[model samples]
Target chain A: MDRKMSPETRSALEKLADWFRARSIWMLHYCTGCGAVELPPSMTSRFDMERFGIGPMATPRQADVLLITGYLATKTLRRVIYTYEQMQTPKYVIGFGSCTINGGIYYDSYNVITRLDLYLPVDIYIAGCMPRPEAILTAFNKLREMIEKGEANGWKRYEENKEWYRANQLKALNGEVYVTR
Target chain B: MNLKELISELKNKYRVLDEKFNDPNHTFVSIVPDQLHAALGELKSYGWKHLSTISCVDWIDDNEFELVYHLWNWDSRSQISLKTRISRSNPHFPTIMHIFPTAKYYERDIHEFFGVEFDGNSEMEPLFLEFWDDIPPMRKDFDPLKYSREKFGERDYKVPFADFIVEEGDQK
Candidate 1:
């Protein structure tokens, strides 16, 4: 007996899944740089990010979002790749501050990487040296909106362009990052 | 013994090339590389018991490497910087671990950054910089900008307008 559901019913179920995913987002509590200073206020009663169902998770296994807070040195980038690979699918990456966009003040630094998008797929970027708590909340709201509309699909893009990202990672990290999975 | 007596005793005992008193509490004594071990041991016996740190500087033009060992006397609050120079091409200095056992990590740090071989220190392995392939970065001749550009590429931008707009007065 064929137990396949109708196309309309499948689409409705997917819409419900997107709605749940957009509401509850568990961000990894990993601070890469100085940009992490703003997160305390955002998570506290002053801004109250929990009302929107976004909270910090201790482990990447339960996290839906990975926030690259600031500039990533060559050594840290390897660890960041390992962390990103450990995350389950449907994961989203938010590149915080101008450091992830270009290199910010560390443009000419020998150890700091210039661009983050070359290695990982970034869904949205918050532009500032160190964005305030309000800006961070605004970015979270925008990310929720994107998820609701099914527009933020960086995880899918990562799977499709795995080889290209791997090449860029090897080039920057001197072929040291080993992805166990 | 006071600073004056200490300086005279060091001069009479070891090969003290030059001595300069920065202030009453601080002093710098330059010595040959061969006399570093003996001088440091004597200084330790003279109540300068603390070996604060060991720092290295690359004198590229002179083709020499200057190693400064800062020793502190807690009793009198006086500090002495024992300085020594070794040939840049063949930089090797005996490890001061016998006199100051804490110098093992400092020697490893100097070896990692400046490429100076500290004899008798078996653990000269890299303290930092994982999988470092190029020359020592702290050396003056190693261009950091070139290395960064070659390994990690720069970002490209396409301007919507002209490359440069020159004002009438600013034009050469």
Candidate 2:
């Protein structure tokens, strides 16, 4: 007997899952640059990030979203990959500043990885050198909407194309060259 | 004694290549590399004890590395920048760790960036760049842009005209 779920039933189940995911979001933010400063104001009484049911978590394993605050230097990117992999499925990556989008002022930096999307699947990007608390609130609201619509599928994308992302990471990180004067 | 008297005494001992009073409080004294250590020691004895910073300037045209040792006198409330030019081919300078212990980190920084070896400092390993595997980045010969391109692959950029809105007056 072939027991296949009907189209309507499957769609309804997905919508329920999306609703639950949208309501409870645990974030692990790596404060690598100046953009980390804006978070304190937003998370505090002034902006109140907790109102959206999005709160910070210490460990990656307990988190659903990885918040990359700013620039990912070659070294920090290595650690980020380790943390990202440790996270459970249905994970999201929120790229915080212009640094994560295109390396910001460190665009010409030898060690700074420019385009973050090449390495990690970014669910949402809040642009600006350091996006204000208001902008941060707006971006989070947009992210929730994306979640509700079953659109924030970065973790699924990561799973589907794991090999390509790994190759890019290795190319950027693993190398031993001649260091001379 | 005073700054003038101290510099006059130093002129009698060391080869003063050039001397300039840049500002009311800042004085620069350029000297040969051979007498750098001895001159610095005498200056320390004359209450010029504070080591402000150690900086390096690459003179690729002259094929030399200029090492500047910035010192401060608390009593006189003035700064003295002792400058010395060393051969670029054999870029080595004696560490002034005996006079200024904090110079260890500064020497290591200079060693990492400029490829200038501080002979007396045993900890010659990198200070800032931990896993750096390239030529001294601060040198004029080492092209940072080329190095960055080689190490970090850039994005294949194209014009995204669809995202832009040109104003009617600006278009003309």
Candidate 3:
């Protein structure tokens, strides 16, 4: 009666865990920008995202995914970092809109950050000034596939590269970002 | 009373430096800084009850900062833009909060962006910006692009798009 499982058994257990995790994804309803406008349509009757077993969670503590919608101003970036860190492990980060990719129209803005991946590990990036509800659903399905494959491990990357992420966060926020608890 | 009568009334009491009717509903009246308090008080009593906003313009060439107080009269359905110029170096203007009461936040906003010191407004905290190190962002001399690149890192582009112009013959 050996307590430690072999590699074959471990992988099978992981697959089972991945299947459960893939089916149910609770995203934190933290709308950081204008891209939030598209979420209402997707969550409601028209797009009906609940059918996919993906829904918005009120707190970061319970969420499996953190959806960063549109531009992140330096002021808002600090709070967002805290939120990301607070979320439980096995978390995924979805960079929504072109703004999150390369700052979009706010590329040269004094306050807006250019690249989001510098501060956090992004699992996926949905392009467009704002990706439509259909695009959002597509991204969700893609995320589900990635989760099942264990490819969407941004949380693990963040944990491993914490120092690099912290330095970038400190630089953008002018040395004023601290995640307590 | 109508705008003409109101203008005549303001002219009699205060030294109206300049007056211009931009349209039928809007008028701009420039007055000396010294007469600002009294003039605003008089206008408030005469039915210009709404203090819409206080805006500032940095006139670098003239070495002056123009503070515009936009007031609206509900009864008359007209707008008055009360304008005053302060020395750019000094950048101090007495707060109109005592008269308008609503000028407190507007004055704070002006102080944050333009570095204007509203003398009596005590709550002149940074309205929008947080932990701002450089000079007031909205000032004429402050380069936003330079500040942005310095603070928030710029995206490094490998290709020089400027040099890659497609010639007319290349299209074919």
Candidate 4:
């Protein structure tokens, strides 16, 4: 799965995949923090994320993107990993706030993980404490652009760097040492 | 009952150590640790039926943990905070589940956060902070920043922001 494809084959296949992925984005809304409140406005009448074909899915299996809406604690991050891995291939992760980027005000918090990317591959980051609904809409548009360009290969990055990502996950979650002991 | 009548009644029945009125509707009373159960029992018997919550404050400097049992009298429309100080080294307190059955959860929370053992509360398992392996997190000595640094890796900024600042017209 990690093998590199020739440029011609890669381009042809990715072009078709990207075209379909750009229009319809099924999101797994695993909201674990305060930023979840901002999503309602974005999905509702005023913003209408569905207008761009971005809609929430109940389970990760059906989703194309995983939307991590806020700060992830060590406990919740475990569940996030399970959800991320369950997502179908060519999946993307939209890290929702400064919390996902650098932990926001929870930077020194003992429970919250400082970065989202260390555990799962992130395709786009919406930068705010709790990003406004408009910012979320903009982020979704940017993600669509990335998808169309075939530049958002976070799922592939995860496939290639599984060992690195897993090691970081173990270190963050206290590793096999905690599991065994 | 009026606030003065209630205070005077409390004074007449038991030795009140210290009393402070924060407002017309709220009062705080501090008593010895030994008197906690009895005091709460007495208050519960006297129409102070509401157990708002049981909270603990770690007085690390004084080597004590102050347990505050907040009670409310719905009829009188007033609140009373009953306080008692227990030794920090051996922080154990009796369960007042008989007086307030809801105290079971409160005791569990106190046990989880402050490491205070509540005797008779057999279901003193963790209420929050599941699978926590370290010292009770709410203690004054538990440095959360140090814990966070040791656990969650902070991002290393390769280019410090100050170094990237551009002076006026320097871009040209």
Candidate 5:
């Protein structure tokens, strides 16, 4: 006899897959620099953010999408990392603009951090000094599809390195290294 | 509410204004420091909730410095860039954080970078450059190249490299 599928088990598996495929997301409005200017238009009537079932979430705890807009000065980096950590399971990150990728015109900037990935995991990057509203909407649709496909596992990564991530978080929270010796 | 109407109103109100600069989507008004608050208040009455940033340009050759206040007005869907000038001797201005809460942070950043003090921003504190002071390097009068030359002490590293290659050639 073939061993693969029981009738009840197959139905449950199909439902679970559908649930993952319908994941609608909410983005946190966190912009540390110029790239933030694009969000207003993108989410407003110009791009009609509601069309894709994605909208801005004011707090990280309840959101799935964390859109980091631009230039993270060391001071701002701390706050950004804290916000990322606060985000609940199934979270995602969209790095917006050239500054979020490689710091753009601010590449030689002394105060801005050169790479955002050093601080948090980034799933999608929108490339531009300031990406157009259309580009942002496109990026959002892509992220939604990835989420539905279960390609982005925001919580699993956090679970794998909870301690290491906690240490990095603590260093920003207080001056101590946050490692248990 | 839009840049065109706002520009028209500002032109009518302020006497020290200069020629305006308009790009495809941005409009800037240049005014003396004394007129900045009044002009900004005009925008605030509309729906300008955000003070995007304060950019400073030091033009020593021209004997003046330019401060541009980039404001984001959500309702109008445009950035109203306001310009102001101050004497190089002692650049000072009233903090507009009273009108826009966000200005406080941008003002602090500008205060450290350009050494322009905001009179009413009590929360103004250094957010960068932990401990060190000379003239504000971003100031128009502050010559970073001169400072680099003086601090690093002029030296020719290429000459030594060339001499090393010449000696290697001689050996060969």
Candidate 6:
């Protein structure tokens, strides 16, 4: 049952892909680390995120994507979660760097939360201590595909397993997720 | 070139920008928490471009966390760093989110990290650290090392297996 599309069919597919890729994404404009210091250069004339219709938004209510720059602290986690919750449905999260993914430079420190996924559902996880602006743009493109396919809602699991997440949230020093056998 | 001229110009035109200090990279102007809005408005008129990056530093021993608004302009390769020290006890300040779109994120981050209240921030919740106390770490006195050592044990690492051959120095 292997059926390959013809040239005209492929051309239409390409056009659909381009349309999805061009969707405008508004950033919540949150930056919580030294990594955030690098964002201005990318959002400005250098990277020109506006060229793709991606721009910074004033409110989470209007954002299509939440970009967590780096190093989540516990107290900050509450606010990040709150804001993420406020965003309308059909949203995506882009974990900007290693710190957002796994606390790259701050792993040894317990005060900072290592994984951002624990707070909000992330669509594309870009890895690097401080990824270049190009990496961010690449992640945005990857997100467009995910958005079209609708796979970024993996966080639904958190809603489904509320007690499990709470238990993990309130766990003791082992940093363990579940309570016991 | 010197700070005096800049201070004089600002003082003459605007009644804001209190407690000015000369830092290596740029000038540090301490605006009283109340005057931040006016000061920012005046700065914006000169093409500050609303590059607001608000962050907090813990100064717990002093019962304060310094909230900084680092604004920059691409038009001119210069920046005017505005700072305000607020009491950690109440930890509230007027939200600059209205003046600059970028402040939405920056203020939300400060609110979450330091438990500092930005009166009208679009997002008042946390940013990075989710499971944390009201204790603000960036304050000069939050002692991250102490927090880490207490929460997690001493650093754990496997021993290195490489054996080095020592060579004597050519005469002590």
TM-score to true structure, per model: 0.89, 0.85, 0.90, 0.88, 0.48, 0.46
Instruction: Candidate 4: list runs displaced more than 4 Å.
Output: A1-11, A174-181, B158-172
Candidate 5 local lDDT, residue A24: 63
Query: In model 4, how well does chain A match by TM-score?
Result: 0.91
lDDT by residue (A42-89, candidate 1, tens digit) is: 999899999999999988899999999999998888888888889997
lDDT of 2 by residue, B1-172 (tens): 7777777888999999999988868889999988999999888988889998999999999999999999999998988999999999999889999989989999999999999999999899977674777778888888766766666666676658956878778776
Report clashes for each candidate as comma-separated counts: 0, 0, 0, 0, 0, 21
- Report the C-alpha lDDT of model 6 over B49-149, residue by residue, as the tens digit: 65757767777678887887887766755678877788878888877766787788777776665667878765776576534553665555467766654
Ten-residue segment with the worst summed lDDT in candidate 5 chain B? B148-157
Which runs of model 2 end up more than 4 angstroms from their true locations?
Answer: A1-15, A174-181, B156-172
Q: What lDDT tens digits, residue by residue, belong to model 3 across residues B1-172?
A: 8899989988998999999999988999999999998988888888899999999999999999999999999998999999999999989988888898888999999999999999989899887877778889889999988887777777675557867878888875
Worst 10 residues of 3 chain B by lDDT: B151-160
TM-score of 4: 0.88
Q: Write the per-residue lDDT of candidate 3 for residues A16-35, one digit (tens) a residue.
A: 89889999999985687899
TM-score of 3: 0.90
List A-chain TM-scores for all predictions. 0.91, 0.89, 0.91, 0.91, 0.78, 0.76
Candidate 6 C-alpha lDDT tens digits along A12-98: 675575456448777885688767876788789888878877888989899878888887765556567677778875567788888
> What docking grade does candidate 3 earn?
medium
Q: Pick the candidate with the highest DockQ.
A: 3
**Under CAPRI classification, how is model 1 graded?**
medium
Interface CA RMSD, all predictions = 1.2, 2.0, 1.2, 1.6, 10.0, 5.6
What is the DockQ ranking, best to worst?
Answer: 3, 1, 4, 2, 6, 5
The alpha-carbon RMSD values of the candidates against the true structure, listed in the order shown, are: 5.3, 5.5, 5.0, 4.7, 14.2, 14.0
Cα-based lDDT at residue A136, candidate 3: 95
Cα lDDT tens digits, model 4, B6-114, are: 7887777767888899999999988888877888888888889999999999999999999999999999899999888999999888899988999999999999999
